[model samples]
Target: MQSLLRWGTERGAKHSCLQVMQDNAPALRLYEKLGYKEVYSYWYRIRPMST
Candidate 1:
């Protein structure tokens, strides 16, 4: 991700964002190690609609 961040920065990307499943431990650890912080949380839900 460091490399990607560098690429993005070089391409004029002021900030970079990524998406990862909440339960992905290794990915979380790697991001943290690379200085990425948890700015917020996300979730998805399903619902049935009936008329």
Candidate 2:
């Protein structure tokens, strides 16, 4: 992941973005260890239609 971010920066990327589920504590920890911070968060909602 770090290598990919570096490659993107080399190609002119100013920032890197990624998404992980709120329940994914391990992955979140990894990203945080790599200098990533949470900028925003969101959730999905769904409904069923009557037949």
Candidate 3:
């Protein structure tokens, strides 16, 4: 991940972003450790399922 970000920076990239599920604990922790922060929230609409 660091390498990828560095590569982008080398090419003049200004910012980076990614999406992860709210319930993803481990990934969230890792990203936080890497200096990421929550910028926004979103939801996915789904149809009701028949029982």
Give the whole-model CA lDDT for all candidates, comma-separated: 0.86, 0.92, 0.93
- Give lDDT tens digits, candidate 2, residues 1-51: 888988999999998888999999999999999999999998888788889
Better of 1 and 2 by TM-score: 2
Residue 6 accuracy (lDDT) in model 3? 96
Q: Which stretches of candidate 1 lie over 4 Å from their true place?
A: 48-51
TM-score of every candidate relative to the true structure = 0.77, 0.83, 0.83
Per-residue lDDT tens digits for candidate 3, residues 1-51, read 889999999999989998999999999998898799999997899999999
Query: Which one wins on lDDT?
Result: 3
What are the per-residue Cα lDDT tens digits for candidate 1 across 1-51? 778898989999997777889899999999888878889888988787888
Model 3: how far residue 51 lies from native, Å: 9.6
Supply candidate 1's per-residue lDDT for 11: 95
Residue 47 shift from truth in candidate 1, angstroms: 2.0
- Cand. 1 Cα-lDDT: 0.86
Provide the clashing-pair count of each candidate structure: 0, 0, 0
Choose 2 or 3, whichever is better by lDDT: 3
